[model samples]
Target: MTAAKTETFTSLAASVLDIEARSVSDLKRYLDANFTRACECLLACKGRVIVLGMGKSGHIGGKIAATLASTGTPAFFVHPGEASHGDLGMITSDDVVLAISNSGETGEVLSIAPLIKRRGAHLISMTGNPQSTLAELADVHICIAVEQEACPLGLAPTSSTTATLAMGDALAVALLHARGFTADDFAMSHPGGSLGRRLLLHIHDVMHKGERMPLVNADASLSDALLEMSRKGLGMTGIVDAQQRLVGVFTDGDLRRILDQRIDVHQAQIDRVMTRNPITISADVLAAEGLKLMEDRKINGLFAVDDAQKPVGALNMHDLLKAGVM
Candidate 1:
């Protein structure tokens, strides 16, 4: 594109970002008694937080529901239009209804507001107009008002939607903290994701064990350790003592350095050439912790040890990579 066109596009994007950011910042002023009451309503809710909205509001409500559900609160989105059909049965009196409407006059959302109330559910409204009918009927109203839309025509739901989403995030995070939600708790809700893998997967779950483990006696010749490393294909071998306790570790890096010193691989003792007092991890520790230890110590392999310092398992960086722990 031409320089003038490029400049115009960049300026427009920057303006949109600035407007949306300011709208989110302005939402802080609206976090009054109503926001606190809304939080209490949700926290005390024995049932799910039924989020209701239409169109653009519905999209944001769905994300808000997901965030609330994953963080600590139990929540789900019920389309207002569908609620009028048969989905209204999903809501219970013990639940809290979080209704979203940028104009606070959305026909679909307003149509079901009375039914939600009749069910004895607590109604929390999020809107730009606190005086709007839906807001007026709500037990608590959170104002997500924006000065103007990012749209040049000021008709689209740009800045308003951004503000609404930020407010929803604030509510979820506050609830998360109140409930003492932890990373492990979050990981349980996201077991299929990388974060879950990092938090939930243990060293024994990914490390080489049984015949897959490369190990040799500390008094064994370097050639014997090399044979074990070669057979296991881990580029390393754990050198153990008479009681099968880990004494040292021999790796490809050691081989390179030893070769430069003209050490006889066949005649040299494994313990003499191996790295003594190598870093180790327990089998119960998280694989992510193992990765951290490896990175911090500048090593590629780790031996999983038991209380007696016996090598129970072994793994290299490639093992972690294959296990998706990297």
Candidate 2:
């Protein structure tokens, strides 16, 4: 492209960004008692929150529905065109219908609004014009008005769509907080994602248990503990009392510290050179918590203990890395 054309394109892009940013900021004016009522309505909904829209608004509504679903609200999106044909059956008396239209006069959306009300479902309209037909028909109206479109022709739905999406996010997040939604709750809806792995995976899910655990009797020699660590390849070995309860942990770092002291590895008891009363996490705790514990302690390995303080499993940083928990 010519230099002149490139400069023109860059200037247009900057102007679009500035306009969209202001449009989103301008949405602050729309959050009133109605917004709270909308959130409270969704919170009290015994059925799903059904979102409806046409064209570009439909695309944005789908994303809004997905966000709400992932964040603890039960929601889904149905196209207005589809709703007119038969998809209106998806809504119920206990449900709440959220309709989106930039101009508030989308024919398809209007065609289904009365049927939705007749079905006993509450209606919430999101639009750029509050006085329009669809807005006036709603039990609650959220305005997503923008001063102007980013499209130079002023015919496209740029700034308006951005404001609508931001308003949707505001609603979802408000409901999320009101419902006491947590990371674990969010993770449940997204089990295939990385956040799910971090929030849902427990130490027992990745630790080496049973015969794979590296453990030695408290009376065992340091050399014996080293052999167990080498065999198990965990870089550490847990020391247990005669009752099979964990008493201490001997790691490669301890070996390094003791090497200069000239301690007799052959005759030294495992518990003598081990870290006494080491930090321990229960097997049922989240792997992410275990990772945080290890990082805070600056340690490379950990032992998962049962109620009796006996080592049930063992793991190191490498195992966490392999399990995608790091």
Candidate 3:
């Protein structure tokens, strides 16, 4: 890149960062009675939060809606222009409308203000101009004013948009805390992602169960145990008693240790080299918990035992990796 081009980009980036920093810092003073009022209004809302905005504000509103939804506040974004064209039907008296417009004078958003109010829905507005018409009509107004735009032209919404998004995040988090939203609740809303898999997946869902679990009798020969482990492809075999109770575990790691001792694998009974009373898990435990156990104990695999202490399942580190719980 040319030096001139690099300078221009660097200056613009610095301006944007400085403006946003000031915008967020200025928000502390606004967290007064008005912010409390807005939170209380939202807390009293019986239904969903209906977010609406236009232009740059609308883009921020979409993200705000997603944050609110994932944080335990049921919310969805509606384009104000579309709301006037038929989407307003989605709003009900039980819902609360959160409208965003820096000028507080977006034509599309103003167009539905009366319709929303007529439906007896609560109206909340986030704007740079509290005196503007949209704020005047709103039941609650949040100020997101900035000292100046990052744009040298002082026209584009750089700092103002960032401030608005930050305010929306603040509101969502306040409501989340008020509702006591938990990580598990967030996981439920995001099950398709790795986080959800880690938080929600249980050992029973991914562990090899029933006869598929690699297992051998305590009296089994080393060759027999090896065949069981090979067939199950779990790299380990459980040694069980006559009543199918887990007695020990034989793994590839154990094989190496035994080899170092110059033991004859061909003639040895698997029980002699197996780890007795190995660490095990219950079928109902979360996969994430299983991973933690393995990491903390410095082990690579676990057996899932039933109420009577009989081996019912088996799982390993690879299982967690495959299930996206690692």
Candidate 4:
């Protein structure tokens, strides 16, 4: 492209962004009793929120439904075109229908409005024109009007779609707060994602337990501690007392320092070289917290202890990395 064409493209992109931003900002004025009623209707709904739209609005509706479903609201999108061809059976009397149309007179959406009403389902319309047929027939009408389209010809759905999406997000977030939705709750809906791993994975779920735990008695020889560390492959061993209470930890880093001193590994006692009163974590804490602790303490290994400070489990930076906690 020529320099003048490049400048024109950049200017057009900036104008689009500015127009879309203003459209969303303008929606704040429309958050009146209708928005509150929309939230209340959704909260009181016993069945899923059935979102219906066509074309560009349908795409936005699908995302809106997904956001609502993941944020403590039961929702799903039903394409208006599909709805007329047997998908209408998916809706029930207890459900709430969220119908979106930038023009407020989409034929496919309007064609099924009466059937939805006949089923006793509540209808909430989101439209750019409040006086349109859909708004008049809806139990609650949310106006998503934008002054102009970001398209230079004023024929595309750019600014209008942005406003509709923003309104949907506003409703989802408001309902999320009203329902006191938490990270743990959100994790339940997205258990396969990284956020779910961070919120739902506990230390006990990933730490090496039982015989996998690297441990040695406090009176054991340095060679014995080394053997346990090598066998467990965690690069560390816990030093415990006769009652099995963890008294200290000996790691590969400690070995490097001890080797520099020319210590006799065969005869040296573990207690003499061990780090006493080392930092520890409970098995019940989130693995993400363990990652933070490892970063903060500048250590790669940690012991998961019982209430009595007994080493019940062991983990290293490699273990966390393998478990997707790193």
lDDT (CA) per prediction: 0.93, 0.92, 0.92, 0.96
Worst 10 residues of 4 by lDDT: 317-326
Model 4 alpha-carbon drift over 4 Å, by segment: 1-3
TM-score (C-alpha) between model 4 and the true structure? 0.97
lDDT of 2 by residue, 78-191 (tens): 998888778888899999999999999999999989999999999999998999999999999988889999999999889988888899999999999999999889989988
- The collision pairs in model 2 are none
In model 4, state the lDDT of residue 277. Answer: 96
Clashing pairs in 3: none
TM-score of each model, paired residue for residue:
0.98, 0.91, 0.95, 0.97
* Model 1 spans > 4 angstroms off: none
User: Which is the winner by TM-score between candidate 2 and candidate 4?
Assistant: 4
Tens digit per residue, CA lDDT, model 4, 1-326: 79999999999999999999999999999999999999999999999999999999999999999999999999999999999999999999999999999999999999999999999999999999999999999999999999999999999889999999999999999999999999999999999888889899999999999999999998999999999989999999999999999999999999999999999999999999999999999999999999999999999999999998888898988988888876
TM-score comparison, 2 vs 3, better candidate: 3
Query: What is the alpha-carbon lDDT for the whole of candidate 4?
Result: 0.96
Better of 1 and 3 by lDDT: 1
The residue-by-residue lDDT of candidate 3 on 4-73, one tens digit each, is: 9999998889878988899898988888888889999888989999999899999999999999999998
